[model samples]
Target chain A: MIKFSWEFHAAIENYKRMKRIVEFYVEGFTNLPDWARSVWFIILLKLLIMFVIFKLFFFQNKLKKEFSNDEDRANYVIEQITIP
Target chain B: MFESVDLSLVNWSRAQFALTAMYHWIFVPLTLGLGFIIAFMETIYVKTGNPEWKRITKFWMKLFGINFAIGVATGIILEFEFGTNWSNYSWFVGDIFGAPLAIEGIMAFFMESTFVAVMFFGWGKVSKKFHLMSTWLTAIGANLSAVWILVANAWMQDPRGMKFNPDTARNEMVNFWEVFLSPSAVTKFLHTSTSGFVLASVFVVGVSAWFILKRREILFAKRSMVVAATFGAVASVMLIASGDSSAREMAHTQPMKFAAMEALYEGKTNAPLVAIGLIGDPQDDPMDSTAHEDFRLKIEIPNMLSYMAFLKVDAFVPGIKDLILGNKERGIMSYKEKIVRGYEAQQTLVAYKKAKKEKSADEAVLRAKFDDPQWIDNYFKYFGYGSYYDPDPLQLEKNAFTMIPPISLTFYAFHIMVILGGHFFMLFLAILWLLFKNKLENNRIVLWTAVWTIPLVYIASEAGWIVAEVGRQPWVIQDLMTTSKAVSQIDTSSVMLTFFLFAFTFTALLIAEIKILTKQIKIGPKKEGRKQ
Candidate 1:
């Protein structure tokens, strides 16, 4: 017969106890006030901030002027128009 | 429970789907990216009336056509596989999943395919402005296709905006907006689309660089590089930002996965992200028990995980050990167990209700018997512990099935993609600065960097996908249906034969694509004065 030590049993018990505590903590959130639900709402706020920063600051004006010569020449010709 | 599955059949089905999906993905990114490139080229043509720009647009369009054809071919098989290999899954989630597929066909597919025809054939037949509009429409169509497909895929992973329909024995869509606005759907779409842009940019830059290296079509190469580098720089940076948000979303929605990705076993505040480590094979029994003994060798950067997840250094991200242990105590079963328990619970509840309605004392006694502590315990124990205690019975029943692939590969692949993305962001920005200073053309190192980074873009796209699809394993639809339950009742040998045939044909087409692309690259984009 393989004999298990008391210490191993104690460790298992401790694990079970810790697990119970964590469960209680999570369960507490279920009955939490509306304010607590707001904590999860922060993720949405951050996403908006990221999108604005990405679109406005990062991607804006970053595209290269590949056909600048033709554009510039066309603009110059338009600028020289005498009659509307 | 009566479903019969041969191991070889299941394995072959899985292999076929995986292979086809992987191959299809190779073309998908190029299509998304090149579509945008063509749109921009046409925009330029419209604005400037430059014939040279028009010529460049036509040149790129040819390559896009080749990629589009392959993308369509491989994509057809994926939709068919859901009905064939995963018949049970299709029936289970068909109410919810099928909606997006139908929408894709009606809305996105029609828009893209119709415009694609016009874009390809309408150039000479229609006015220039009309042709340009057609190009833009095609680009939008491609992205629309992405939107619908991703909407369907995202529902599988997270499964929001839906309700269970007992009448149909499947989940039905309750809110279309919820499905469309799912956190996973948005982040994944942006990240995937941006990756496609990166791939397209790199392809253009690489081909152009090759042209310059040979000292042929110098002006064309120079122009192409400018456009490619700009798109590459912006897209690379955006990929990092979107990837960061995607990771954070995963941390919130799928904490176990986030923990797995970081290889965390314990709960800790300000957890450091690990860049790379040898993850011990968890399938090996003795090895798995000792897996965490010397598990994490090094923390790549202290508090990196916290920063990524919470955008704050002191923020906490829970580990797998914490999540699993926490769930066990909470009586929260594993996803598969939960599904089974849910079914059993529903059945028992129905029986109880029927007994009450019929006013049958014996039936009432039977229903009340199920409510007894011993009976309830036995039910859970039989369903849950039966696999552990009696393995043969469990084997007889197809209790385990995963639509998602392995985690370890996806975890590492995601990290590598992020690291590479960061590197390229800096490299492209530096190259942009150099180009502005007129020194980029003269620098051998910068030119070569542009050349090599082209393939890195595709690698990153593939890795990102592996993370997305593989991370959502075991269920075709999380908490709703198992993949084994989903596979169509087909003979195993038949699928295996078809699998080999597809693999061969796909390989041949891929080779042909490469040969044509290589020959074109060597010829250097139809130069006016340069000799062949």
Candidate 2:
């Protein structure tokens, strides 16, 4: 019979145990410390402001939005590329 | 160094292509991996009738759209650049290389564009099973596109299933299926795809870890981490395995490139792999003007490189010096002979063209001489050598081998990739352990580590390319064409201007992309009406 290394199996078992324990511990995450919760609000607020600026100012995609037909969209792109 | 040649044109063309390709790469990998993640989330959502899974799926899908748009935008430029900046190369191998690209556009792209709309907009518009199928189809389409592109790239590196036609002045495909099933293409696709998966997994895990750290979207963050860690572990293992096979393939097909990657300049039976340590400057040809000899410091794994290349404990592996210096015993000829032979072949072609143009009496004989099987084989073998720029042919042949790309870049890039691979193994193991223990929220250090690994994984992906592309120096199509010769006959200044134009435009879009992606992640999965 071919013998495999004990450490290999043992390590796998140990990992399995750790994974099992953490599977349930992660459920306790909904309730958090005030600091963690507050930081999230700040991150979200910053993200919202950035998103608004982007939506309003950058990446308008005028051709896709304005042109209903493929030919028109194609013409716009070619004209843009061709224009001096 | 820049005195007597059209240096600026070649440099700018290379720079321009590199700029587009690198930017395009940043988005392609993300698209490849994220498609599957979103699809999996949606599938689960459909199966369980759980609105929370749908929320998770929707959140990721938004980021995927942003990345996919940029990838497409940059990809169009890449294809156009091939026509504009590399016209000579386009015509040279157009017959053989153009097929896969055409297939990619038709078969893969149409499938992706069709289903992606359904995936994004058909949540309530379509049946659950239909929507799930669309999501899966979108992912399959994205990966299928990758297959064709990599197949095209693999042909350049390996260049099989094709023979050079002097009369037509192009390479014609001998067999389409053989090129499709090229061993290099398979390994490249697998390696690239697996790494893309790893990149996506890490990005998902990192962002989820951030959410957990900030204590927001608790259910979303934990569940996402679980999916990423599990999927990541499998892909990480596959990534390493595919990389091994890819390296062995490179060793066989492009031995000089493999040697440069290892910084091995002399052939040896018990070659050591340089695991870590800094080497001298690339230009510093200390001691025999070879990369291996220029090493100032290094810690090498004895006989490891030989084992990796040959799967033997003590197998002889030739280094750059052995290849450059010519090993008669090993039946290895030097670059000098190749350069001369290449020049002779070019001369024959020029004469044949002139003869045919003038309709001279000896035109038939000249054509016959050029087409002689053995002579043509040698010509094709050394074709890249003709691209050398020295005015004196003898001088050019003498110094050609000295110009096998920058060795230091290849060496360091390889080391960084290997180190990152090691880190990924450990990181995936830890994340899995934490998930098993259900302590993902409590482990602040581990959570933060996962969060920061996003940028590191990007660096690792970039390094992988550097190893692959830069390692194969001089040759654009290995042994067939040099990069210098493949460039279009455009003026230098125009290319430089266009390069900057692209650089500025891409950077702006890149900034917008990052901002939008971060914003979406900060929003997290929306609150579901139904519970899991």
Candidate 3:
């Protein structure tokens, strides 16, 4: 924070508008809400579960196991989606 | 010290990015091509009410799903890599390139991912028409994604719809529509997508041929071959047409790449095409620096190069020799001169920034100098050049000629791709003919030929990329910025470490996917399906 202040001060003193704007954004980022910080971790965890864990275990091969043949598969599909 | 550090950083970053792109491409074209083929099969099933068609569609869909997952995985790294490795380039053209990429995610990827769920899981969970629609949507989504990716890549080769903002120290988007509808982008998308289609066709045909060779599922194998051959033949025609137009487009927008591809060293009218190229034997010609001069032996097609480049019999095309050493007669300026202009503009920009920062008495003077239209028209355009002076002092003998990309790689890669393309063209015709005569299954020779050509087609596709990319060396975004300048300011070791990690992971996944896919293919379509 101290180092950033020095850099930000230098830019502000020099009147580097682009640098100033960037520094302001950086400052805002450093103070990001607690919820926002956890959001990153949650997203990362979700992605891991969705792409890796679920893929490896839950979704291996459904087409071959559920039905004996293509027609049986088609019939099973029609039965499920027909709204009873 | 800093120079060497930056150089290593750039090289490592570039190496990682290239490796990832190559790996991603292996799976992507298959996904792009096979997705549509699955849709085609499902459509036939719907129309004919043949359960065999459904079986075929499902089989291909299984393969597509496996490949698509990995392609998606590797592709995520490519986007992140832009920020991690080529951050400078991202900042410079983000205003333009980001739009297409954002649209790709929001529009194409979502549509594809959504329907993909319905296509895969909704088989027994949805009505026949609904499932069919979902499958078609999935295919459309995949192709649409390719279009956006190609557009982003094309913009790098021929930058448009943006103006360099001196104040922001970056390029800013000025016209969204121009960027979206660029002819270069459209042509590139067309050529790239069709190539994927042809690759997918060959893959399908090859797998079917294997089944036929086993003397099992002969009917299913023959029918799949018929569909693939027909699809591939139409795609091959489109591929050739798109390729020709792409060549013309390159000649207009990226003349250096065009010159390197043909190995032409000297500017000329009526330049002959080397139909069969033999390159670089020092015993024959030690002085061979450009494509034309490098050809040790060749069969030339009269005026074809000129015709291809300009759509005219006698149009002039500038080569490496003319572009570097300067062509007085042709009014083609040298790279050295451009470098000088760039350096001057860079110096002025630095001065302007300093003055603006300090707000000193010289600020007005510097601002006035910057405002001069003449300065912007001339020197400012070359502001991206790293040096007006020689970049290396020890290599005093080195000139702009040395900066031209190595011609041999581009030339050979191009020739190999062309040769493979010709092979596919003939093979497609033969397969189509055999299918028409109902003798496809009996033709053992062509069946083997079709089966073997699948991997070779993939090789040809990679070679085509090598030709396009390596042929445009030094430039990451062409004249706008060199690759060295475009790299993120990061340490080399960090990049190298991540590169190997990704390579190992991807390779492992690829091996697993191949094992599973081959096993599934060996199983063939279920015979029990016919009981209905």
Considering DockQ, which of the candidate structures 1 and 2 is the better prediction for this target? Answer: 2
List the global CA lDDT of all models.
0.64, 0.76, 0.74
TM-score of each: 0.73, 0.82, 0.81
Per-residue lDDT tens digits of candidate 3, residues B158-180? 77777765555566777877777
lDDT of 2 by residue, B1-532 (tens): 6564445788788888888788878888988898988888887888898888888888788778767754564665666667667755776785677888888888665898778767755656578998899999999899998898899999999988887665656678889888989989999999999899889989989998998899898788878877877778889899988999998899898888898888787888978888887877655432244334667788989999989999996988888877766789878877767766776666666666667779998789877865577877877567667555356755664466555766878888989988997887688889889888888789999988998899999999999988888888677898777776677656677677678867886686677678767866776665654221
Model 2 compared with the native: what TM-score? 0.82
Between candidates 2 and 3, which one is better according to TM-score?
A: 2
Write down the lDDT that model 1 would get.
0.64
User: Candidate 1 residues B171-284, lDDT tens each?
Assistant: 567798999999989988888888888888888877776676667777777777777678888888788788888899888776656766766656668888887666665533
Candidate 3 regions with alpha-carbon error over 4 angstroms? A1-84, B1-7, B282-292, B361-377, B391-399, B528-532
Candidate with more favorable, higher lDDT: 1 or 2: 2
Q: How big is the RMSD of model 1? A: 25.5
Q: Could you report the Cα RMSD, in angstroms, for every candidate shown?
A: 25.5, 14.4, 17.7
Candidate No. with top DockQ: 2
TM-score of model 2, chain A? Answer: 0.45
